[model samples]
Target: MKVLVIGATGYAGHRIATALRRRGHDVTGLTRDLAGAGARALAAAEIRPVAGELADPAGYREHLWDADVVVHTAMDYADPAGSDRALIAELVAAPRHLVYTTGISLHGRVDTPELDEESPSSPDNPLHFRYQLERELIASGLPHTIVRPAFLYGHDSRTSQLGRWFAAPRFVGDKDKRWSFVHVDDLAEAYVRIVERADAPLGDIFVIGEENPPPALEVFTAAFRAAGHAGEVTVHPISPEEWLEQAADQDERVNSAKARRELGWTPRHAGPIAGMATYYAAWQAANA
Candidate 1:
């Protein structure tokens, strides 16, 4: 299968593109810079890199139309909703097997002990725009699968915030706030399975994460020790108003049984606590 991965130079997109290539698919990654470090890394991995932008579909329309599957992992942090809305509109016109990346943050503060694909989006979810995007994609009648990955970690993922936390270990808002996590390599495998079974059905949602989640304090402390930092992690308290505005104060433990049972996707890495040392080392190498 020929696959086109947008934002292929990104943290998750790069890994997903390489995994598809390793699975014997013809994979091309759309990157902003062909001569940048990320594009060079893609070339080193034997994946072709093409220059393009998500905000401008015409620049990458040919690549989009040429692929058997189009995986969108690029997101504009400054205007995430706007960027996704435009991309989805373009995708709706040229339908293909699409794998869209969403995040557990969309679920917001879950009242339940464990959130899953079926969980309802919290009313106060700050990223409600993402839910709107998901609805738009589903209603577009496109054959697409939505993947909501838990907090992504490992392999130099800045999303984990471990690198900064290692330098100054601290917890914002709630120390006991639990969050689910998935290794980047393991998340890439989930994408591989989803793409391989593209013919199955549309509108399937997968929450990709490890089985159990740990509190923020524990996870951070373990990472600090793993990075050879010997000190107590500071706890920063914030008002409920402040926390609610951020929409990240509540626990976000997730269940990935759906991905495991349906996509036959099993996460290979142990949780973040178990692989802290290896992950810290990878982050250092990438930053170096």
Candidate 2:
């Protein structure tokens, strides 16, 4: 199948794009510019990266027009209200099966440890606007599915959430906070399966998360040691206000039971406990 990934250069998007290509799908990755580190990463991954901007549909309309599936994993998207509205309008008009990527952070400060796809929505999150965008896509009667993936890791240790462990004397987070850590490779495979399989029904929500939700301190402590850091990996208490401002505490433990049961997506890494070491090795090689 021909696939068009809008955020092909992004951390999540790049991984998913590489996964799709590995599956032998004709994939085209859309990037705003074909320069700098992102381009190098795409090349190293053997993904076909095209210079296309998500903000301007006209620039990427040709690629989108020809793709059988369009997966949007773009982050830090342009001006939320206006840009998203226009982008959604164009997407709905495309008449293609669209898979929109969202994050577990949308669950937002949930105190529960085993939240699922049916859990209550967050009152506020940085990606709260995507909820509205999701609604618009489904309401448009387009064949689309939403993927709310867990905290992403792997590929680049420094790019991972646990990255602070390497440089900082101590990391900050509530010890009580737990997150369903998802390896980027596993999450990417989930996307490929969702797009390739006909069983992934429209308007359905699937979580790309792990069954094992690890505490923040435990995960980072392993990461700290993996990074060859000294002293204890400090776990500081972050205020709700601080979390809201910086999106620091995205600690909502979630389960991908539906995905596992239906889509047969089994995440490889349960958490950062062991993967951190492997990722650190990769980070060292890349930085060296």
Candidate 3:
């Protein structure tokens, strides 16, 4: 299979691209800079790097049409809705399988014990646009699969924000608010399974995360300890609405049984707390 990974230089994108290449697929990585470090790194891994922009389909539409599969991991935080909307519009006409990346945050605050792909999305959440995007992509009648991963950690993941808090070791919202997590490498494997399974139904949605989720207090405490901090972690209280606005601070517990049953995907790594020490070291190396 020939695969083209957009935003291939990013944390999750890079890992997904490499995993596909390792599986003997012809993989091409689309990035903004073809001569920069990320593109060079992709080339080093034997994945072709092509210069492109998510906002401008003309830059990457040819590559998209050329691939047997197209995985979109690119995100424009400045204009996420606009960029993603543009990409989805272009993907509607492409004759290929699409593995679109959406975050578990789209589920909003997990008021129930747990939620899955069938759960209703909370439009109150700041990232409600993503839920709308997911709907748009599905209704487009494209051969696509949507993956909503929980907080991604491992291997220099800035998204996890563990490194930022390692210095002070604190929980900014409800300490007991639980959140789901997945190692980047494990998430990559989920994508590999999705791509390899040719029989997967269109508009399928998969929630990717480890089995059990821990509270904010537990996650940060483990991260601090892993980074060799012996001090007590500070707690800061905030309103529930404020928490929801932060997105990362709200409860994000989710069930991945559907992914396991349908895609045969199993996360090999224990949750973040179990492997924080090693993950901390990897983050340090990547940042250094």
lDDT winner among the candidates? 3
After the best TM-score superposition of candidate 1, give how far the Cα of residue 282 lies from its true spot, in angstroms. Answer: 1.4
Show pairs that collide, candidate 1.
none
Give per-residue lDDT, candidate 2, residue 275.
Answer: 67
Q: What pairs collide in candidate 2?
A: none
Clashes of each: 0, 0, 0
Off by over 4 Å in 3: 237-245
Write down the TM-score for model 2: 0.89
RMSD of each: 2.2, 2.5, 2.1
Error of 3 at 271 (Å): 1.1
Off by over 4 Å in 2: 35-37, 40-46, 77-81, 167-169, 237-250
lDDT of 2 by residue, 1-288 (tens): 999887888778888899998889888888777886787777787777788766677777878779899898885434655655565677677778888877677666555667777765565665566666777777888788889887777766444565545556365555667777788889898998898887556778888777656677777778777877767556666555554324536566777789988888897765667667787776677668
Runs in model 1 deviating more than 4 A are: 238-245
lDDT of each: 0.83, 0.74, 0.83
Name the better of 2 and 3 by lDDT.
3
